[model samples]
Target: MKKLLVITCFLLAGMGFANAQQTSPVWPGCEDADDVKKCFNQKLSKHVQQNYVYPKNEAGEYVRGKVTISFQIDENGKVVVNSVEGAKPKVNQAAKEMILKIPEMEPGTLNGEPDARNFTVPFNF
Candidate 1:
């Protein structure tokens, strides 16, 4: 019983430590600015708007769909697409391409050390 209590305390303390140390990656130009997270999100939205092209079907009609894209900013500051959900294949491909074009950023940190972090965005057309 005493061992179990000690393990529980350790686990809770670890969770708090992890949460306290988590930090989001900063976009290229926002590295030194205040509000890094807001800057990162704004840049991300602008990037998608500038680069994402909704694919057209064989009939030459634009495919209207929403895609939820998941990607990771790796320790090297490169975007690595993990998955795309809820879109046609062409739309998914477009989403992936746009995400891949994200410029290298300063990777996120955990406990003051670089860490890979996942980000998700939804594209609606």
Candidate 2:
């Protein structure tokens, strides 16, 4: 029975350590949020809406397309655009600009150390 108890204690401690290994990046205002992930998503959507600018063609018509942006928050909490893919160059540029406007926040963690986090977002214009 003593041996079994020792094994169980070790297993519990290992599980706790594993749970602390990874965490999502925290948005500036979400430090006290109940659900950090949801708060992050809300802030991201708001940022996109506020910064998005419609692109226009040379003929003066609005350019419409879907853009997929892949970005990362580095260990220093800086936003870095990895790639922007879209149907039109103007749309891709617009998406990249909007993403680049995101404010720096706390970096995520992996294995209890600051780590980079990647995200992929889609936008339609």
Candidate 3:
């Protein structure tokens, strides 16, 4: 009886997890692609690397640090930068700007309804 109970619990938990998965946001150029999530991630990394600009301090020395930029894709599919953590002011600002440059995407969905989803990107400079 105890074993049956445990198995039932496990099955229930698996069903809950399967239903909890949300639909990922569609990247601008990946709208027609089969795998939106994977394409979005790949494009995001490439975008950050391509647009990254190292910040320079007053003495013209390169700012060396890292920041984790957090943002959300709102219901309208616009990128809204929420916070930047663990970096100098200039570094943080640069990271925010870079993330903001991401083109508008198709908003993520939860249960077939548009929803806001958070994402994080790390920048090392």
Candidate 4:
């Protein structure tokens, strides 16, 4: 219970920080010359389909909770798994690993080139 709160707080803080930062328009998962949002969404959907699994607790019980996941799409289009907010360490770790399986995107473009961008996503299971 306590860990969950801490994780939630951290996720909220991270999201708030992201929101405060400059909303630079870079192609999310594709070249800046392309549609940024479209690429990002497509890549993200592919990732979820490939790696996401329903959560399970240590007691072998189905765990129902919302996970806050953070990742970065680098200029080279590699996924950098950052953090996951969950009730238990195992749950959080699982979510992190699952998110890490996200396939590399085409990378974001700032000016017809690659640019780094952070993404915050929530996974509920």
Candidate 5:
């Protein structure tokens, strides 16, 4: 009976920890969004589509590659590109430029305090 009581206590404590709330960084127009995360994703996709530029090789052929970009929305609500990786340098540079164009907005929160949020996304060109 003592062991059962201890296990139940532990489980309840774990549940409390699991329920901690964390929020994603809010996009510029997502201040009143019902689902902030979904809104953020939609805004990010739109920004990428609008800002993406295709790179061309010396022969004027379009460069084809995929880039993985890692970035963070800082506690001050600024976009910072952490890294970009791709087969070709041009592709990486293009992806980096696109991510850098993201506008600053309200920072995300962890437990209701401003917190930085990291994101990794892939781009194809």
Candidate 6:
């Protein structure tokens, strides 16, 4: 279909541009920003509730765990998760699942073009 060809062309162009422009490595298994975000937000919504025992920042409790939610902003302005680093194994493990559930934003770019970039998120419970 015409759309597929258009997409392929864009992706190929993106690949070339990405290689030359990318400073940080983008996450694998994704073709676009939305896909990457879906991997984190929508896909893992249920998993977070079930697996992560951490309370939301909204809940004012005293726990000492930190999850650094890191992700990439790809050329198309999609927010993608690069990794989730945590202070504890439990936190990191829980975050890893939650990380995949986040939805990508419009990927970032350099010089008015989309480029793969990383972001950090912090969660405490």
Clashing pairs in 4: none
Per model, how many backbone clashes are there? 0, 0, 0, 0, 0, 22
- State, as a TM-score between 0 and 1, how close model 3 is to the true structure: 0.79
Q: Of the candidates shown, which would achieve the greatest TM-score relative to the real structure? A: 1
Per-candidate Cα RMSD to the true structure, in Å, reads 2.2, 5.1, 3.2, 12.6, 2.7, 13.3
Evaluate model 3: give its lDDT: 0.87
* lDDT digits (tens) for residues 88-122 of candidate 3: 88888878888889889889988788999998877
lDDT tens digits, residue span 1-125, model 5: 99999999999999987987888899999999999999999999999889988889999998879889999999999999999998999889988898999999899988899999999998777
Would you list the clashing residue pairs of candidate 5?
Answer: none
Q: Give each model a TM-score.
A: 0.86, 0.83, 0.79, 0.61, 0.84, 0.41
Q: What is the lDDT of residue 66 in candidate 5?
A: 89
Q: Give the per-residue lDDT of model 4 (tens digit) for 1-125.
A: 99999999999999886665333333344555365677657766776777766567678886666778888978787879877777766667777888777666666556456777888888775
Q: Could you give candidate 2's per-residue lDDT for residues 74-97 as a string of tens digits? A: 999999999999879999998899
Flag regions of model 4 displaced more than 4 Å: 1-36
lDDT of each: 0.87, 0.93, 0.87, 0.70, 0.92, 0.59
Error of 3 at 112 (Å): 1.7
Q: How many backbone clashes does candidate 5 have?
A: 0
TM-score of 5: 0.84
Give the candidates in order of TM-score, highest first.
1, 5, 2, 3, 4, 6
Better of 5 and 6 by lDDT: 5
Report residue 79 deviation for candidate 2 (angstroms): 0.5
Query: Regarding TM-score, does 1 or 6 come out ahead?
Result: 1
Model 6 RMSD in Å is 13.3
